[model samples]
Target chain A: MKLAYYPGCVSRSTGKEMDVSTRIVCAALGIALQELEDWNCCGATHVPSELVSVGLAARNLAQTDLPIMTSCSICYSNLRSAALTMEDPQVRAKVNAVLTKKYSGAQIRHALDVILEVLEKNDELITVPLKDLKVAPYYGCLLTRPRGGIDQPEFPTILEKLIKTLAAEPLDFRLKTFCCGGPIFMPQEQAAEDIAFLILKEAKKAGAEVIVTVCPLCHLMLDAKQKALEQRYGEKIGIPVLYVTQLVGIALGLNPDELGLEMNAVSPMPVVEKVYEKMAEEA
Target chain B: MAADEEFKQEVLRLAGPEVLTCIQCGTCSASCPTAHLMKPSIRRLVKHCLEGKKEEALRNETIWLCTSCQLCTVRCPRGIRPKAVVTALKELAEREKIKGKDQAYEELFQRQIKDYGRIAEILLSGEFMFVFPQGALQSMELGLEMAPKGKIKLAVEKIRGRDEVRRIMEELGKG
Candidate 1:
């Protein structure tokens, strides 16, 4: 299967691991990701709030002929929201008019939807089972909110299914869709820190050694901000925040470094080392 | 009496008539994650907005602390969208130029949209470091340590859409 991949901005930079691991895992699954040529930013949370129609149109133009695949949660939401909005005739007319003026005809699909479709089609690719891995799947806000398609706005089942496919138990946590305070980081740093702290705290309480996420923004806010959150909250959140793709790569027996696992603020080595020990014991 | 009336009118304008519908059920405040940090309850803030007590609602930092996840909106039995109410209050505050510490973050976001046309990592990290002084050193250390290890890219290629993004921002009147 072929997918037009959109790594978004964060994945191109700080969240490169998400891009790396996603490519590795997809390759293992025999999925070809043809990156969309000269793709632009998705306008994220800001554009949608300000100019909904234009934002949707701009995103639609970036998509190629094939279905779109993204690693960023915010990017996923923005793309999904745009696609959902364009489905409405009135919205489609208005957005299409704008898009036609800017660029030529275009269409888009949410990365999560694409990922799920790929997994469904090639369920057998998850050959190496991820045994005894307790993953607390964190959805954050974008993937699940503001009324969209694919998953329920508040509660999503996609990540849970993906985790289960890899043979891991998905732990239930109250703050699954809770904001990692990604948007608030600049305007309300302390508030953002507190929010992240609370989410990590909840994940820890829920018995998750690793928090798997689909969004690069959530990954950045949770993984990158751990030290600051711990310093402010006076508690260490030892759980490693990982991109779901990275876990899939690990399960597929890909090299850890190739997945860019070391770039994470919270080192995933402890978890990986433990998993390896268990695998060795079983062997 | 006139001042009290004006206050009530302002709150009513901001929160809408539904603010009066609040039964002080404490549902919003109870469910709020940052409730412990708030001095007055979010319920009270909504009540104040409903009563045109705009000053009290805008003065409280709790309004900014809201994650806007709409959890309270779901929890409200009377269909009071406290998050929206808080947002309305925030808009009022912004129009009034009631600057909060985090206002710079808004500027930073604007800068991203206006100048780069995209959210660049180096720029965001620079902004983050500027806002949090400790981040500056940490980021520097990270740059020095991670660059050689290939964990950090010294110069990442900026998308050509930077100018296009700028034009888009200008068209939106945000640039």
Candidate 2:
């Protein structure tokens, strides 16, 4: 059950909570996460050079014989894309020419898949059955994209299914697969906010008590930039945005601090308190 | 038109020829979350490229506006990767040295890749905000908000194999 964990830049820094929660949740599920030693950036499509992006991702891919698992969707896509790019022997040779360790390619998995597989095998892992908590599963564009993967690219049910397994209600969110404007956060700031607002407004309109995000960048858009979105739009969309792992950790009866619940900018305290209240009422 | 055709061929090489299968259904523009913000929507970007308006396709800022969400790529009836097309266009623009915030951000990002092998949120973003004054004020306000929550930090972490990343970056500096 060992996974070569690739915590992308956001998870390591701005989204540190995601890394913490992912580690704790995996450990609780008896999944030993061996972090890739001295992993480089995934290059995240921002780097001008595609070879650099693929090479950097390939560098991390080479570090493991074990399947790679990452929390960030961008990192996941970049790694998988790099693996696909390296499928060309010519491309691999070109990339490997500069590498300290040669990487042909490696299988990469998302933390969602890992956690979902574990929970599907045994439901008892969900100690805190989020009981009737209406959740909006926000896939936010990148999670189920770039074509041909585990979930339906447009109408993904992975997040919904995961929420259902937690004894929570997954709202029929129409905008689940919409963009959170993570890539253009700086370049097109207003447009990015507008895009995130659309998703948030839709989740709110769908009657979601909490919005669950699989990617850290989505969390950054929906959770971190939420307050600014409200101020600009003149709306009180205070719905809690929790990392999917944070929710899973809560359902596993893990401590809030261990999950880095407090580090969330929007304060998933409401979800945290509700978990305790649900526990109390059940008691 | 000949020049535009040459540009289109380059785009085909970079993004893949599937983009030529685009039927101009506007599905890409429709599915695009930020198409409204782009001067020429992704559909129009395709049309311009197909029609051989190289400037409209390459330098119109629409490519830079892409979030790379790939919704259009998934939803395109022709299965065209609009994001790739846009990325290819973006790469072309950078080659042309089209100056703007997007290039600024890219340069900022590349520097991070060179130095630490990873992007430090604060340094990359901080320098970007410093150079590009367009949206920095509000973004800085957001940064200030994130500061006290321990959500962000000022430190930039360096990877153990920094020299290797620098080497790879140097080796690929041509493209």
Candidate number with greatest lDDT: 2
TM-score of each: 0.78, 0.96
Please list all clashing residue pairs in model 2, or write none if there are none.
Answer: none
What stretches of model 2 exceed 4 Å from their correct place? B173-175
TM-score of each candidate's B chain against the true B chain? 0.68, 0.90
RMSD of each: 4.7, 1.7
Candidate 2 lDDT score at position B51: 76
lDDT of 1 by residue, A1-283 (tens): 7877877776656778888888887787777999866566676644323333245335445557766777776776667656655555754564444342333334455555566677777777664567788899898776765554557756778888888877788998888977787665555656667777888999999999899987776786688767766776789787899998888777667778988888787889887777777778888
Best by TM-score: 2
Per-residue lDDT of candidate 2, residues A96-188 (tens digit): 988898895598899998999999998987878999899998887777777655587877898888998998999999988888888888877
Worst 10 residues of 2 chain A by lDDT: A141-150
True interface contacts retained by model 1:
0.21
Q: What lDDT tens digits, residue by residue, belong to model 2 across residues B19-69?
A: 788888999899888878788888998888777788878777788888888
Q: Per-residue error at A239 for model 2, in Å?
A: 0.9
Evaluate candidate 1 by giving its C-alpha RMSD to the native, one decimal.
4.7
